[model samples]
Structure formats: C-alpha cells, structure tokens
Target: MAKEETVLQGMIDRLIEIGRCYGMEMNVEKTKLMKISRQPTPATIKIDQKQLENVKCFKYFGSLLTDDGRCSCEIKSRMAMAKAAFSKKKNLFTSKLDLNLRKKLVKCYISSIALYGAEIRTLRAVDQKHSESFEMWCWRRMEKISWTDYVRNEEVLFRVSEQRNILHEIRKWKANWIGRVLRRNCLLKEVIEGKIEGRV
Candidate 1:
C-alpha cells in the first residue's frame, strides 16, 4: 500500500529537494502560498484606504482632496510648494523663539495686506486675496528689504531680487493680476524704505 500525498506538504518537499540540488536556501518566512477560487474570471479589488494618512504616509507628499471630492496630487503639490516658500520667508522675517509665533506672523501678513492702509478695521483677513498671493508678496518684501542702505549683504539681496523676478514672470505667464499688484507693492515698499525713488 502507498501513502497518500498531502498537497502543500508535497509542494514543500519538492521545493526543498530542488533547492538542495542548486545549493540554495528558501526563506519560508518571506513566502506566501495562495489557492485560487473556482472562478473563470479574475476577481476585482477596491481599496478604501486614505492616501493622506499623516502617521504612516510620507511627509510633504500625500493625497489631498478638494471639498468636491476631487483627488489631485498636482494641486496638493503646488499648494505645498507655496506653503514651503511662505515658511522659508517667514523664518527669515521673524524671531525664532516660539513655534506658534510663525503662525501669528503669517496671519499678520494676510491681515496687513488686506487692510492695505485702511482705517477702523475689525477682523483680519486670513485667506488669500485676488490682488496677490502671500508667498509672492513675502518674496517681494524680502527683496525690497535686502536692497536697503542698512542691509549690506549683496548675496541675499541678489538672490531675493532674482527670485522675485522669476515669480513675476511666472505670474505674468499665468495672466494673474497678482503679478501687477506684486510689482506695484514691491516698488512702493522700496520707495517707503528710501532704497529707491522716482518711478520705481
């Protein structure tokens, strides 16, 4: 009488014998075996996982969705870039004592631009305006400051100036009115600082 062969046991015995002959070792811990169901067509799978999980997902790179349920990685990346630029500028603009102070400064930046020399103001604006983006305005202001008589760092001056120019061109290409406001405000800030005069 012959012994009946166990399906999984027989497969493991065959694999081990083959591996021994080839002087190789198989990592059973890293291996998985599956049995297919009796179906003629392949099964479909739907993943309901959230892409922007902060704990397990990558930082500065995650899925962002709109209020309308549009999952756009490109839009998220652009927003992230804008926020990063604002963050870098905010670091240079304020003291580094408290983490919460940066948020306050950003809120101030938004409010300052929104007021725009207004009187009797109540609540401050926290959202972006059609006239300018906070990121662009920050770079423009930095450049304006760098060119002042008190600041003698030519490298910083040139870098901020160059960046402002590049951002200006990008805004122009996008036909954004913010570009015009950026230029006007930049010139105005420079004038106020007594760095340059006469028609910007």
Candidate 2:
C-alpha cells in the first residue's frame, strides 16, 4: 500500500508540476485513480492534495475491466449494449426485407458492437456461452423466430443463411493477434518470450 501510494502521489505531483509549467492545470476534482489489482488495499491517493476516488472497474478499449480478470461483467455489458442496439434499429429491419440483407445488418451493426473488444479477453466457458447465445439471439430476432416456434439455434442460423461459427471468429481474431505479435520485435514479444518457466 505504501509503495503504490507513494508512486501514485509522486506521479500526480509531477503531473501538477508539469501542468504549471505549461500553464494548463488539470481539474483535480475530475481526476480519478483506478488501480488494477485483484487484492487492493485501502489507500488515500491525493491529487493536488485532494483525494482522488479509487474505482473498482474502469472502461478501457471498449471493454469493462475489473480488478479480477474475469469476463462475466464484460459479457453482460456487451449483451446489454447489443440488445439496446437491436432495439434501437428494430423498426428499420422490416419483415419484408430480404433475409440476407437482415443478416448483413445484424452482423454489421449488432455483432460488431457485441464482439468489438472480445479478441483480447481470455474467455471462460460461460463467457463463450454468452457470446454464442447473443449471436443466436440476434439471428432469431432477424428471422422473426420466437419461443412459440420450436426452432433450434442451428435452424435459425440456417434460415438466416448464416454460419454457426461465432466462436471461431473470436479464435481467428486471437490467432491474428498472436501472428502479429510473433512478427513484431517489441515490448509485448519480449515480455512473452522472457517468461519461460516451463521447458520440456
């Protein structure tokens, strides 16, 4: 606690000093400190002698990051946002529209939002379940299938002329990221290569 607090305070003090030099001061009231740790200790982090609030979760890159490295919150948040996107454009997607066009719109708008930052997450089984279910939910809505209709997810995908491979899409993205990282001679590659605890 003491070490992190001192470091944070030092950073804040330096920022304030630099801002004074540039004649542009930061709003201490608006500044917040978010420490990423699974086990966080209570510490009063001050900015400009004013206490900055410590947040449990912070938004980064488009995903919600918590102190714990779990994807449940991110999955739920994405689902809610995706449902909102779908509901907002529900009127525009008419029944008379071509099935292919409806599928295209769902993929382009809704899926893009739901899966925006999913590639970086180390997804658990339940996280993947939510992602797959969300995809089928959108497909069913586009095909106008309801609970009353005894239709399976595969049937919904078939009706919409879509592929039942949302999980593979995420895997493909992860693979692409790994490929890029492997080819780069940078910090990420060095960090990954430096940690070699197991060799067989």
Q: Which of the numbered candidates is closest to the native, going by highest TM-score?
A: 2
Query: What is the Å distance of residue 9 in model 1 from its true position?
Result: 37
lDDT of 2 at 160: 72
Q: Which regions of candidate 2 fall more than 4 Å away from where they truly are?
A: 1-3, 92-94, 148-150, 186-200
- How do all models score by TM-score? 0.20, 0.80
**Tens-digit lDDT string for candidate 1 (137-185):** 4434444453344543445435444332323433344454557678899
- In the range 1-200, model 2's lDDT, one tens digit per residue, is 22477887787788889889989888877766666556765568776567887777778777798766577898899889989999899866646777778778887898888888777888899888888888888877776789689998777777777787789988998999888776564655556787543322
Check candidate 1 and list the clashing pairs.
none
Q: List the residue pairs that clash in candidate 2.
A: none
